[model samples]
Target: MQQSPVDGLDLVFYNVPHAEAPAELTFAIPSMKAYCGSEIVAHTLHNLYTLRGAKVRDTLKWVGYLDQALDHTQDTEIFFAQHHWPVWGNKNIQKFITVQRDSYKFIHDQTVRMINAGMNGAEIAEAIKFPETLDQELSIHGYYGTLKHNARAVYQYYMGWFDANPANLDSLPPTQVAKEYVELAGGENAMIKLAQKAYTQANYRWAAELLKHVLNYNPNNKQAKDLQIKTFSQLGYMAEASTWRNFYLTGAMELETGAPRKGVSTEMLLEMLEHTPIERFLESMAASLNADRAKDVDMVINLVFSDLNESYQISVKNSVMHFKAVPKAENVHTTLTLTKPFFLKMVTGQSGALDLMFSKETKIDGSRLDLRRFFSLIDKAPGTFPIVTRK
Candidate 1:
């Protein structure tokens, strides 16, 4: 019999700890302490782009964990975290964790309170304020995540992008709106003069907005672009949060010069895709499908992964693609049998339909034309589209 990876190793797995009782461990060290923080009680909430925005419920859960730690580690002399410095002395540790926990709760409860009062994300962001108890604490200050943005994030987590305004529900795109705004402001020159006045008054935010409208209406307007770049630089310098600073600076860079040619390497991308399930790839492909092109066509393709011994039936109808992992469909317009690696290559553009048809590693059965048609309907995104300016 073969021994598994942990066959001879001692290990302990436990369920999540509750506020009433926490999972405890002992270590031979001078200071008897606990490491209570993880993603929750960092110096600030470093909210990155996950599938969904960061949730206040998660923050509240961390507060519960902190409560458990406080209850269980009464004699603990030190406390540490995943990021930043550690706290020493039981009294100081207690104060630190208590403030950190309350700060999140404050943001969450207050945002909800304002939301219930009929205020939208932007309104709540500007209106919400922290009590002096949490506000005066340096540990919970917005170094990575601002209270303003987090307030809005909490709003988005609850209410989504819509702010309950009927006019905003179906507004024109930014370019068209900019054209209207610029014309209303008299002309491009008038817009620039207003932006210059705002910049002179050190109101970079308003200046940036006006310049954005001018540039959106005419991207090649050199004067507007230059002023916008300067405005972005000022905003970047003024930002307290590192994320906001980086975003503003990056926007300035992209506007002044073109977007950088560099991006994630193909090898790195393929490695990431390798770990992702085939269902997600199919979903992404469906999302990228050109609906206009596929509206008049209907096709079905059977994909067989010979190495993985998995097969899926994919059907396109009414400009939408539906996929299922089942026995190969008898009515499939095309059947392609290939290894997972070859399939990855095809999806990533390293291999085309001709390669699939001709390669010794793949076997194709049924209509080649249908297979080609399927690939053609999937739009290929340009890797480096402009961000701060018109493409």
Candidate 2:
């Protein structure tokens, strides 16, 4: 609407439907978010990736609104998305919006088609590339998101979180698997040497690929360190996702110099915690636990937040931690009474909820040493990670 006068065409910000439009093309992101301002449509597209697609597992129904985003696909000569830009001409805009809205729709629809046809998300994503004409566009690139991930999300939208494989239901996690991979690959040094050879052979991609697995298990190995540096350089030199480029570059930097995680904002964490599923919070805590060191230690801490009127009983028995919310009926160990913001900090180790022990902010009836030991039990997953392969 703020264009510098296009042939004296009325610069009307048309909120009218495509059925009413007599314009070139209509562009939108389907929705909007931070970073990309209004007028440009953007979807975070993370949940788009996680749920359904991987070969290992599938996801269940996505409870979010899909139609609310897609229904605005009418009345446009061209539609410009916020992340990229707009495509022009009535035919083009209609096709573009239809393609995109239908892209999510197709993945959702055709996936059920394929799922009924006996294919999974991984199988479907591999088979579901858009036509060459659409795929050629750089804006449709898999910089931040990929077809594979999106397809899986659609699968999750219907089937729920499961890969239909029992082994994966209770299988070893990524880090544990990575550790075993390192052992089988004749240790980190051997893999690093292999990665170096690949890098030297101008196979920067393969080198980066092999090196990440080595680093995942032994993040501090000198050879793994050096190879990853080269890999980041290669990725940074070629990446289109500024965020992806930054993730690779920053991860490389952190490997050389162990950068401690600066805590996520307390307000944001509290907002997330207050409404997030208790299971998800426990999963977050499980991700927080240092599985390598989590052994025979067993303990539990009960916390009560007066403001929210909630109580949680967390038991760390046999190194596995369990957290559940309930009424504070019987006192167990520690009763940390604090605001949600302080509790978020306590979980992340940025600040303490147990500071009541010293600050006189609240009351506590648990062992001080037990509280400290409990804090030591969990591991923190990183906010971002490097992509080993480009797809």
Candidate 3:
């Protein structure tokens, strides 16, 4: 029985094909491909909001599922994965499963071994190598997930961003450091010349790095910006991984023009958020609170959703927001009662402070000024920001 919700609801279903029955056909969802790298690796290596980094242990378990299927389906004449073409013949199927299983295990075990030897993520990434048995096989080649980045991901999974170097414990921000670097390199012109030299040598990575420092120091430097765009294009063309290529090319595009104004539609966003639990939205609001603005304020507001019959207590103290789902607090400075639809409308900006203050359906039981103060502490984000250029 699957423990979690298959499609947002708990389900119980019998597994077809008893263990003892001969299996001429078998199907398996490749969880290893989802977590590890498949035909294309997802751009989740350093994204903190998602899974953060690949969970090596979970990856192994996914491959183990495939291995288990292989054991049960020894007589299976055909095997197929959800995303790939089917494999025929039992021996061919066995080889395919074994190769994939070993590939994931190899990455996990080898990365951990390097971690124990006092090598940091970058160093481990540079030194790790695949054996000929795995290297020669096209099935495990890094068309999607390169060995270099995946090894670094494994390091990130265990050690995090810190490399134990005291000098890097609290380094300056990138822009500040970039300014210092440009000044040390004898100004922007000299940096551009150096970057030009690297670019001429087809050392696009080094050229991009140098140009990045130049651009960071003075985003208006036309010479540096043009060269950087060229460097990004070259790097993008050279990248084997589609994700890396897309990122590099997109960086160039953003630098040439600007970030695209269009994004996910508001209606689509609202629909997605509607299905999400209310606590998650509250958490997002807490994260969006401006700590500096809220430091001097302390407030507790009770939120009552009539449609859901739910009450939550939200408190801000010492520049931190805390939430709890319970009955309304008697000591709360204010209580606002409304339906879930109205609350969501407020969240998505379909409604605003004026709407909240004047809406006929919304009931305000305490000081409206305190409610306004609470809303003021939360900062509004534009949803997109400059990536390759400074604000």
TM-score ranking from best candidate downward: 1, 3, 2
Instruction: Summarize candidate 1's per-residue lDDT along 194-309 as a digit string, tens digits.
Output: 99999999999899999988988998999998898899999989888787888898898988887878654465599887887888988988999999999998889999989888
TM-scores of all candidate predictions against the true structure: 0.85, 0.54, 0.83
Tell me the spans in candidate 3 whose CA falls farther than 4 Å from its real position: 2-58, 72-78, 262-266
* Ten contiguous residues with the weakest lDDT in model 3: 40-49
Residue-wise C-alpha lDDT for candidate 3, range 1-391, written one tens digit per residue:
2333445544222232311122222332222111112221112111111222333334444445546655644665655443446666768767776776676667768989988999888888789888999778776676566777777766776788899999889998889989999999999999999999999999998999999998888888999989999999999899876667888999999888877775544655877878878899899989999999999998999999988899999999999999999998888899999988888888877899999999997999898999999999998777577788765
Q: How many clashing pairs per prediction, in order?
A: 0, 29, 0
Global lDDT of each candidate: 0.76, 0.58, 0.73
Identify the runs in model 2 with alpha carbons over 4 angstroms from their true place.
1-47, 50-93, 105-129, 136-139, 148-202, 210-228, 241-244, 251-302, 312-326, 331-336, 339-354, 365-391
User: TM-score: which is higher, 1 or 2?
Assistant: 1
On the 0 to 100 scale, the lDDT of residue 300 in model 2 is 67
Native-structure RMSD, model 2? 9.5
* lDDT of the structure predicted as candidate 2: 0.58
Per-residue C-alpha lDDT of model 2 across residues 147-197, encoded as one tens digit per residue: 666676667657776778787588876677778877987988787888888
Give the top-scoring candidate (lDDT): 1
Candidate 1 displacement at residue 15 in angstroms: 6.5
